[model samples]
Target: MAAIALSVSTVKPLGDRVFIKVSESEEKTTGGIFLPDSAKEKPQVGEIVAVGPGKRHDNGTIHTIDVAIGDKVLYSKYAGTDIKLGTEEYVLLSEKDILAIVS
Candidate 1:
């Protein structure tokens, strides 16, 4: 058996997929109450880390994705596959899973 090292730079999303680094969840409530780790919600916001070329159209043309790397976006709550690299968290999802680009 062989061992391969996977790093963030080596990850590339294929075909309309986007790789995002998840943002940290809120540690406290708006009311100034501290929340435990288990009570923290999975954040829907993330920054785009890697993106695929684009989706192929019926005519063989590529329909480019709207978001770009470094763009902060909001995605579906349970949309993408969760990934953990070292101590950071990421998600790989289709373009459709993204709801909007945050300013």
Candidate 2:
């Protein structure tokens, strides 16, 4: 799908899901030639723009997610569902798919 660059404020994730703004892949090589879309590698790292409240438990308490909004995270290569709002690209994935906080 074509990329959409929308304001991130419009999204809200629920039930341990997160809204991540995926990092852009390389645009040019050392020779300064721009890479085609087919040559660009999908980025595995992204910044958390929005987060869910947390996963609710059977006991009625909500367990917090490890990552917070604004955190840069590494996730499974094929984890999230890709989405576009306006002109920005985003990924919607469950907390379990996040491998680590980039720090």
Number of the top-ranking candidate, with TM-score as the measure: 1
Cα lDDT for residue 40, candidate 2: 89
User: On residues 1-103, what C-alpha lDDT tens digit does candidate 1 reach at each position?
Assistant: 8997777899999999999999999999999999999999999999999999999999999999999999999999999899999999999999999999999
Q: Taking the tens digit of each residue's C-alpha lDDT, what string does model 2 give over 1-103?
A: 9975456786789999999999988899889999999998889999999999999999999999999989999999999899877666799999999999997
Q: What would you estimate as the lDDT of candidate 2?
A: 0.91
For each candidate in the order shown, give its overall lDDT on alpha carbons. Answer: 0.97, 0.91
Clash numbers, per candidate: 0, 5
Return the clash pairs for model 1, or none.
none
* TM-score versus the correct structure, for each prediction: 0.95, 0.84
